[model samples]
Target chain A: MPFFKITLIRSSIGLPKKTQGVLNALGLRKRMATVFKPVNPSTAGQIMKIKELVAVSEVEAAMTSAEMKALRKPDPGYYIETPGLG
Target chain B: MFGPFRATSPLSGGLLWKIPWRLSSPQKRRQRKRLRLVDNVVATVDAALKRQNMESGRNLVRWKEEMPTEEEMRPKDKYTMFDRKEKKYRKGIHKLPKWTRVSQRINPPGF
Candidate 1:
């Protein structure tokens, strides 16, 4: 199923309490926070409420938080080689 | 003072310790080869680290460029107030109607 990748791009500091609650329900605690939800009417409505504060994209698969972190991490390019003991 | 000439001790006066004879040619060659291999590994690791650093540095610069600035990141309603009691002009963002329909969802077209 397609997923909506919702990223909180702006703060909700002065927005209405209802809007803040919607953001909380969407699991967006701070700016740049990302959450994935199945593409559905309810999720779409929530995104619409905070459309000005977030960036949304459709993704094929929903990634876990750990996977997202790993994607952002830099690769370690080298491996150690050990001598064989005879 | 002297027992049978102890091969273990280089201090024994009668027999001189020969440097070249002790480690045979094959063992010396193997040690030299191992040292060269170690040097090559070190060079490879150094090069890899340099490349990684350069890539990371470029990524950092790009990230800075791509990230939204402070002005752009501020909440849309930051300058506006919800209350009408104040005399000053307040641009209320939440005063707008809540979106209930999926068709009302607004996002960048290409994102």
Candidate 2:
């Protein structure tokens, strides 16, 4: 399924409770936070409610949590060629 | 001659909150920019849906087709909103609560 990659580019502080609730429902907890949601009627409606506070784009597939964590994981200075157990 | 300026609230009979009657030039510029961004997002979604042949994103297609282009918008609509009070039935954007956080693009027809 195509996913809508939403990023909370702007803060929701002091906005209406409804708007804030939409952001919360979208899983955008803070500024610069990003969440991928399947593109559908409900998600589109949510995006419309908080369009001013977010940036949205479409992607082919949602990234898994492991893949996202790997992207953020740093490369250590050294890598072991042989395992201790092996 | 003007005395030394002291920016202080009055002892009594002053409003605790004040909203500007008009949007400043910079504020107007930013507002226009935001509207443009929203338009861009809609267009992007429409294109993405078309590419994937997704029929569920109907709003994106209908919205893009109905909303006026930035160039086609009236100057009044571009910069201000409809208000029952004030001259011309329009007022400064800042007067609206959470003006920056909400979309105020659409106004009453013939307003």
Best by lDDT: 2
Q: Give the chain B TM-score achieved by candidate 1.
A: 0.30
- Give the residue spans of candidate 1 off by over 4 A: A82-86, B1-111
Model 1, range B23-94, lDDT digits (tens) per residue? 345653543443333333223323333443422233223423553332343333222233345354343332
> CA RMSD for every model?
30.6, 4.3
- Residue-wise C-alpha lDDT for candidate 2, range A1-86, written one tens digit per residue: 88999989989998878888998899999998889998776687678667778899998889876888899999998977876785
TM-score of 1: 0.43
lDDT of 2 by residue, B1-111 (tens): 234554545423577556567788999888788878887776666666566666644555556666775666777777788888777788777777877766666688777
Where does the lowest 10-residue lDDT sum fall in candidate 1 chain B? B99-108
Q: Residue B29 in candidate 1 has what lDDT?
A: 52
CAPRI class of candidate 2: acceptable
